[model samples]
Target: MKDTFKHKGLRQQLVNILITKGIRDEKVLNAIGKVPRHLFMDSSFLDHAYQDKAFPIAADQTISQPFTVAFQTELLQVNKTDKVLEIGTGSGYQTAVLCELGVHVYSIERQQELFRKTSNFLPKLGYRAKKLIFGDGYKGLKDEAPFDGIIVTAGAPFVPKPLLSQLKIGGRLVIPVGDAVQVMTLFIRKGAKEFEQHEFGEFRFVPLLEDKN
Candidate 1:
């Protein structure tokens, strides 16, 4: 509940690190600088919150690294008023970042514990997504299909076909695909069933879970 000058200074230092690391989207950077990342983390980790790294959160998930979040979001290329689908709404940190950019986010989290936690916690921080559902990320929100962009916050062993099908014709799907280490992949929907693929380097993420409840 406290975002003091010290927190803001640390947040700015984090933003500077992101800039040096090649994250060029001003809006994305601004979003990164705006949302109180420390607030999203447990107080025990408050000291490390602004560091350019991920930390453990509830339900055994990691709030994605600031660089990772900025990178994925930059590739997704969201716009104000755009509809975006997010998989793995773990910490709601990424969710808040997306919201800060003025997009309508519909996020799915398979871990019921996280889903419930984030569902209640996000609005308290003044970041609200269009919908926060407790469900499988593999099964994209069919009811809210054709999103302008989709971001997967966890590591997927393979690209889920449903996620591709849920994008608008020109939409982008930013996901990390692999096992132990994931290659950050971006798929841009082209024609009816066509997509353009590109791969960034590599990053580690908690596994994207399927609904077991």
Candidate 2:
């Protein structure tokens, strides 16, 4: 239940594993090392927390694998002053990572259970996002649109147009798009109606639900 010395050491090992797997961003590595992933899950799953793999949390959603979190964040290329919107807040692990980078984060969670639990749990750890909205991520945050970066933590069936539309010019939207399996996709908004797209290989994730709350 506490972030002890052993936990911190384990996290450092996880960071080392991530570095070998190609996560080069120092800030991202430090964030991954700093966040106590064990505290994010039930005590029963404590042993699995820093294993660089995803583990189930409440509401059937899994805390993303550490490598995946580092990969998506590295793609965003955001600075401390940037505003990042995170879709699928999940266990708030990713949110905590963004907070470690000192960026303003606005995260959305569709599951009512996760929304309430994470809303309370995250602040207790001192990782307060700009806002944690219990709403549809497919729609993004219109009022808080024009974000410097938007990240979808779940496997969206397809790239939602609104997520792209909400990005500021040159902003990055990192999403995993697929059905049974997902290919990590990145969209960089170059202009009003232009976006550059790139796809990484496959990864698995819980489906990104819509209007489920």
Candidate 3:
């Protein structure tokens, strides 16, 4: 039997985890169900990949728990025409989920090795992210400015001000913010001169650092 399917039992457990943890968006739940989390990790760890737990993947990075991914995606509230910017494409799992939901995804991975691997894996999954960038995610993507939505997977000490400038009016940015401890924050650009902020709750994530690799 494929280790991937063997991991299916964990999926139900993850659903319960999300429900209990407050990730109640139905679209997020469906996306979690459709995307094959096991395919995003090394085969040796595939059995535990769907267990509502984070696991180290490559380049000293980790794929986030299924709940984190679903919670973040649900926070973004993506629409079909939304152009989404994602920071830290660790295992391409979250990126795949965004793509599955019909967003035009532009994902940035500071780790070169992860970038190469995900650039290759995304197409194979049949969900093509618009671009896979290798650069400092902290700087955000300028040329692709005015994104309709943005999701940052890593924890940041503060929200990147430049990223806020790049968001289109009416766009939403969902990011985890803090030092070692973090809070998932939602930023909404209400208009050219206004924005709204909401603090969700605590979350643990790999730090968002500046790097070319």
TM-score of each: 0.98, 0.98, 0.93
State model 1's lDDT: 0.94
Candidate 2 lDDT over residue span 1-213, tens digit each: 478999999999999999899999999999999999998998889988899888889998899999999999999998997999999999999999999999999999999999999999999999989999999999999998899999999999999999899999999999999999999999999999999999999999899998944
CA shift at 123, candidate 3, in angstroms? 0.6
Clashing residue pair totals per candidate (backbone < 3 A)? 0, 0, 3
lDDT score, candidate 3: 0.87
**lDDT of candidate 1 over 31-82, digit per residue (tens):** 9999999988999999999999899999888898999999999999999999
Candidate 3 on 64-145: residue-level lDDT in tens? 9888899889989998869999999889999988988889999999888998988988898798988999889888999999
Itemize residue pairs with steric clashes in candidate 3. 110-213, 111-213, 112-213
Score candidate 3 by TM-score against the native: 0.93
Ranking of candidates on TM-score, top first: 1, 2, 3
Where in model 3 is the C-alpha error above 4 Å?
1-13
Candidate 2 Cα outliers beyond 4 Å, as residue runs: none
Quickly count the clashes in candidate 3: 3
Span of ten consecutive residues with least summed lDDT in model 3: 1-10
Tell me the alpha-carbon RMSD of every candidate. Answer: 0.8, 0.9, 2.0
